[model samples]
Target chain A: MAKLSRRRFLTETSAAIATAPFISTSATRARAQESRKLGFAICGLGRLSESQIAPALARTRHCRLAGLVTGTPAKAEAYMAKYGVPAGSVYSYDTMHRMADDPGIDVVYVATPNALHAEHATRAAAAGKHVFCEKPLEVSVERCRQMIDACKDAGRLLGTAYRCQYDPHHLECIRLVREQVFGAPFIIEAGFGIDVGGPDQWRLKRDLAGGGALMDVGIYALQATRYLTGEEPVVVSALETKTDPAKFAEVDESMVWTTRFPGGVVAHCSTSYKAGGIQNMRVNAERGWFELDPAFFYNGNHGRRSDGQEIRFPEIDLFAAEMDDFAQCILEGRPSKVPGEEGLRDVRIMQAIYESARTGAAVPLA
Target chain B: MAKLSRRRFLTETSAAIATAPFISTSATRARAQESRKLGFAICGLGRLSESQIAPALARTRHCRLAGLVTGTPAKAEAYMAKYGVPAGSVYSYDTMHRMADDPGIDVVYVATPNALHAEHATRAAAAGKHVFCEKPLEVSVERCRQMIDACKDAGRLLGTAYRCQYDPHHLECIRLVREQVFGAPFIIEAGFGIDVGGPDQWRLKRDLAGGGALMDVGIYALQATRYLTGEEPVVVSALETKTDPAKFAEVDESMVWTTRFPGGVVAHCSTSYKAGGIQNMRVNAERGWFELDPAFFYNGNHGRRSDGQEIRFPEIDLFAAEMDDFAQCILEGRPSKVPGEEGLRDVRIMQAIYESARTGAAVPLA
Candidate 1:
């Protein structure tokens, strides 16, 4: 690798994963990789790709928007025209494997529908590109494993795009809890809710999204508890509520879960499509407590502690932070702070939560 | 019943149980009851009795501290001298039945150790006087039932001293949620904790307090959820932590519970003896959320809503409110809002929580 200053390579993000970048992925092309910014081809022109990720890539310091993969021509044309990419850099999803011949794209960020993640990620790996997939990782553990194994077999890194894991506020919260700044946290209450009203959206179709609020928003709460506690839950129980049976016939409208970590940390998490404005996370520690309101928002997040301390961090573009970090990982030939395994852990736990909710019992993790 | 014009017979307590006061107790002493304040013999002389309850009694408009029942002569003499009660009005616990012939003591408020509550309450009932017991009711369900049966057998109205049930803040909170002022409530997060350091105290002894923070302070959180949601839990789960095993060998040092109520409401509650200064309650309603800081405090309780409405209510002397409400119940010939059955419900649910924590499963309520 080119001798980039540790200053340029290191950035203020999660103290919890500060040492992750030093891990040796041992990519033989490290020398070539270090000379230029990592190129990311966003593999789906969905709303997130059109709005947050693409706009964020425009401002990232270490990552460049290199190519587009989409089923629709207008979206591809618009993104290509907007980003100044060559027409040869664009490919339809069916022909994305041809990108193996192109050297412009070093990574593919998969932001497809839930059930389609495994296919896109595998294709990206098979095309000799690192894979960065959005959350839930996929709909099931088996699909996530397929993605993980495909990337490993292809000798390319696989990253899970956990944006909050890179958000400054959540990073600071992780620092506080991991360092025991207010003593050990014993209880975590976290959740996300949005009154998503699209009746025909994929998120409401069980086949497309896999679940309802628990899949779309509840995963945020589950991830918050895991990252903050730095421990996977040992036992989990859940209860679900569905106010409109007709509207949510193919999915769940709301869900609540109770989880117990090995160290005796307990968490209560909830997610809902019926009740909005519920993005918050509270950690009750030994000496005091700290909480974030509007916690999981894309912006304007803030927090405070019980001892009159403000939990503030510098402003950050979440998408840029995540992508830049992934770029650094690629350059260093290391795995990301949020890897495929982390996403797989959450997916398996969420499956247990659903089983518990259905059976009205607590499910213990092995 | 009293001809005391519903003005004196009615009160602003729990809106959830507002209709309880009109139920008839049929004491057959209404003509005698209407002429004077109800006389109460405080059956314990502990710190709570000396500091809060005694001073609160001095200010109660509908009740009088007419007697004292203590094994120690010094405590008996001190209370009698302070309250101006005659020597004959005082009785030792062993001989408390002797007061059955005396007209000065119409009710006995049992504030003994948790394990002794049933004994004292049953004794009071056998003396043909009404019984008002402190929170927890008893150390176990069987004991609580014994007290309830004793009162029923004696044809005496039995009240449980759930002080917050009469706290103005909690009552207003109940009114808001019960009235659906913020649509319908779906989630409740409540708890109380004080770092009581006495390792030799009855609370840590297990036998006296039955459980540690779960019984001592977690009950406050349970009662808050019950009153605020106006529903009993359908299933409950718990996790317990003991930071110092030796210090808490016989009792839990900290405990957390997740409960699902009928009507799709779920609650997360916690209590700790090792972590202090934790008192708050948040209710997630359909349209908005309301929360209280210093929620279960004896004073200075305040709350606010997500819409920026301050959750303020008139300041209240908690002891006076509960005792006066009991007095009104006796005078009106009806059960108090927090009846013995209410306390029994909590004790049994607490048992389920402990069982869940032990077995790592969710316990369903019958």
Candidate 2:
């Protein structure tokens, strides 16, 4: 019977609802027991870890930066000072296994380059810590399988940092296609291209980056096809073009590939280090279509449908959501939405794409 | 100095320049003799001919709709009445060759279905009239070559109705790529798809439509690649998916293809009959990129460069520009920009695409 201001009403109602279920003494005890946050020790001090993951930890409710691991002592010192990490909690790659004695660290987030993902993730699991590795889970399918098995054997949770899987616009696009809102999708066009300047970058190195644009950014295009169709591709045919072979001597400069799904859906995709930045995906169906330009960016992703509908969602911290989701999965004793198997699927497809490009033939996937 | 309005200034300046070049009386007479318009006889009273070609004739500076050919008597009656064409100017398809006796009809524009283009174009050429055939030229490479030979034997110019060639936006895009405005284009993504309704439509018949969406609309995607790169694809790999077999029993429902150019550039393209309308072309180069959505439409085509430059051109009647350009070629005793040879190149590429799709291997273009 009281007329309250909007802010006052919302605050009082939320407080009352929050404490309503804990009124019983047993419920209060259970709530307290389940509210602990996970401590994440990031394994790499690269741009992604320093600029994205560490800052994301500042915003995450269920995860916090508790420790640091780096091969460079300078990087370790810089990250520890920035995040207020205790000197006792810092470890080098050689001493990473010593984290087993540190109860403060719960999960090791492997933010290393593509080639070192499996090594870091496997060691983290062996140390009895949960593992969350950035995409692609590993450079090779076999290595991805090993990482998955190691986590399973250690009875630790494993998650791939496929942040787009938690993005609202991408989720809505997937939902539209899965529900056949536009009628069964028959064609998908997805591409991700970025101009990687300087030939001395790690991405151009065969040992460090694994492949070229496909490994670094083209995986986003590959992932878009799978999630849009919600099915595995049965066959892949690809072509590779290297205009500057001297500059791209170690890996492909650009690649174009076609993927055929089981339900008669075909995806035409491309990735290039030689091209200017472009990230977009389009799905055409029997009745209509939907698309997103800049689909896989950290933010500013918007979508449009054939029926004149625009898909807009509130922007959230992608890394924060991804990290918090993995921590919540560990707390709830559930498997990750983007599990190691999901990363393995993409690795197998990437391998097949490379094979098809090499042999100039269509490679059938198992 | 004269105080002249803008229009009067332009007109007086143009006329004074014209008279200065024709100071001699014979030169003035010769200039008048060279300015007569060409007569265009549309050879199919279908939707495109009725709505686009006939209306465009009203706007052309050097071409006029002087006659009509149709199998349906009612369509002929309707078009003649609508355009104020004399009854004597109408002829049935069986009697189209009699147009040789009518000197008023200078060219026959073949606007029939894909399979009927060869017959109509050849007959028009044999009737001592220049030919302007619609795209895909005739469906098959052999038919296209034969049409070219027929026009050549008759000593008449032949042009394929690739209206996009006359479109200013397309011309600007092509010019940018040809001049290496953004550096040599290394990747191209082009697609054309439309939701063709009903199984009973002529496009669903292999005999009438020649080969479904590729013959009807996919030719645009193929043309975009060639014009943008100014190079032919050396090898092509393709895949076909027919989701609705019952409705698409005689033709492909969807197709995705990859092409490799001589300069190590790759193109990924797709076309589908089951998709909602989508016509777009994007070219990515080493330095920058450019793209056009609705790239192959009759109008409403706009483009943008990666450097934030928007390619905005004044709207012009597509059919009018295409017809006038062909007429000017004939008047100047030269070849058309979109000659029969250009159409043959596309037909060969389309054949390779279909072959690769059937064989599941890359087919080299000869």
Candidate 3:
């Protein structure tokens, strides 16, 4: 085993720097299209939209922040003034459908609460815009299906905001597992959690957040396991724990779920709002293992392998990369790697997990 | 978040170096007893006994390899010749009871197959020798209970070779969790696995090993979870997967189980014979989190805290520390910290996990 410094490894791997062909193609397309940027209208001017997505749009190669849709006029005014957007480009949630008449908005990025994802995404698709919805795609599998159907019927693309799909370190992990670099992965452990703040938050409400930690953070674990194993889990068993009942009266504070994938791959995953910080994914294969701690973060993700190899992909704006990938898919007239169907698969598994937890029995997935 | 070098941290923590009083007492007792070492007769001449326990006994200050019991005459001769033991000190498994007449052997350490643990430990105890049995205690709870009762009737101490209990890094983790240094632990993820070889091996034989990975490596995760949370799980749910049915016809190739403990703590654990290497324990408490990766190894175990503190305890001979701890307890007339009951608790939990796996339902532990 040889020790490789993180700096050397990152430089050698070229981190998230796009390949030559991709850069050349993007430049050629820009020259042909007069450097036209894909105009994005961000729905829901909340913390993530204001702090992460808006800034990420500025950093993206082919995407531009062109419009805003918010229930709060004050937020709309602030965003418009900050981004130098015209008054005509701002619309309230109720008036968002009118954007079908506007050519400035090519994509509607839905960054709303969980329950509103389906509604927002469907409306955006009907308004003749491609839909880029944040994760959990929607509250239920049924809503996810509806969102997907709406986008298909309206001839628009639906891309889920699974940012890790564009992250370089995660991409390397996926490639390694797919290539069987260590041998077939037999077990996967992935989890994500955060110390959530107050009971009054939308995430604590069952109607708003759909579930709890499983809905918010556990999705990352589910996605990681599915991607790592390259198989759908056949069965799922889950357990729920709530230490502070009053604080989590309507939703679970923590959840632990086990899934048995097709090839004897078993995943033990967990998420919690009451517990301290954790974000990691470990895959144990027949010959060796590899893992990423802080796997799903925007930056500072590091990975190592059993063979003393380090995975040190350079840091990139995860949100920027995600938006750019979606833009590239649109420009290429191709489906997204993280498509509506990919989001649907996760929601279906999550539904089974909830069912298993509720019944206290293993639930078979379709 | 101060970064302390491993050397500095180990020096500050003193690793497993016992305080002055303990060292002085051991020295004084050795002098008083004319330097007579307490003798340990290992009951099996298999891989672990030959490779780890015998060498560890040589390193222990208070214990010495005094006798050997093996069904194989060749193994007995080899061990006797290697250790320079008298022929009278070696006994076949059938003649092991005759050791009752020998005064040299003070403790009998059972490192036999799981199914033979109870019979060997009971026979050793009936011979008026203290017993130190390797993990699981026995194949079943009934056998563990009988072994415990036999030791009690003979007025002999019964210890389980849970060496991690004496490992300084694990000890520090236990201390932190027990002392609530990071508030009450709400979630625990523990797993142990190795890529085991050959279907003909004793570990794959259900009759000899009792189970598959759960009987072997999985017990480590179960024990670690209990020790870290300081609580017994009330209910368990499990799922088993066997990808290579031909290779694992009699037992599971992999298993994932979840347990719910008192006070809303949930544990997610997994083990596999076909999986790549993984031995880790992570505890998520209300205030923060901490984890030990490669936790159960004899050496090179490292730990980290949520506060960015590294637990850099110096490497010690884990087997030597464990044997010495047991010898010290015997000399002091105190009970072993990892007593028969501690092993019984884990065995009970394991039984529940197996039942849950069999029925695909949550099984409650009484």
Top DockQ hit: 2
TM-score of each: 0.89, 0.91, 0.88
Error of 3 at B346 (Å): 2.1
Give the per-residue lDDT digits (tens) of candidate 3, residues B1-366. 132243233222221222223324665544523434567888998999988999898898777777888888788887776765557878877887887776667789999998899999989988878899999788899999999999998888899999888889888999988898998888888888877887678887888888888988899899988887788888899988775788888877788899988877889988888865678888888889888988877788888998999987878899999888898776666678999998888888888889988887789885
lDDT of each: 0.82, 0.83, 0.82
Sort every candidate by DockQ, greatest first: 2, 3, 1
B1-366, model 1: which lDDT tens digit per residue? 243233133221211122233344555345434545667889988878898888898788777777788988688777866767668878889998887765667789898889899999988888877898988899899999999999999878899989998887888899999899888787778989888676777778877788888888899999998888788888998888766789889888788888888887888888888776569888878777888888988899998987988989789898998988888876676667899999999999999999998998889996
| lDDT: worst 10-residue window of model 3 chain A | A11-20
The residue ranges of model 3 lying beyond 4 angstroms of the native Cα positions read: A1-35, A198-200, B1-36, B198-200
Could you give candidate 2's per-residue lDDT for residues A1-366 as a string of tens digits? Answer: 232243234333323323332123555434432554577899988988888999999799777787899988788888777776768779999999998876667789999888998899888988878899999888899899999999998888889889999999999999998888988888888988888888877889999889988888889999999988889999899999886889899988889999999888899998888865578888888788888988888899888988999988999999999999887776656678999999999989999999999998899995
- After superposing candidate 1 on the true structure, give the runs of residues whose Cα lies further than 4 Å from its correct spot: A1-35, B1-35
Question: RMSD of each candidate?
Answer: 6.7, 8.1, 10.3
Angstrom error of the Cα, residue B10, model 1: value is: 22
CAPRI category for model 1: acceptable
Order of candidate numbers by TM-score, starting with the best: 2, 1, 3
The residue-by-residue lDDT of candidate 2 on B88-168, one tens digit each, is 768888998898776667789998888898898889888888899888888888899999999888878889889988899
Chain B vs. true chain B: TM-score per candidate? 0.90, 0.90, 0.90
Per-candidate clash tally: 2, 0, 1
**Sliding window of 10 residues with minimal summed lDDT for model 2 chain B:** B14-23
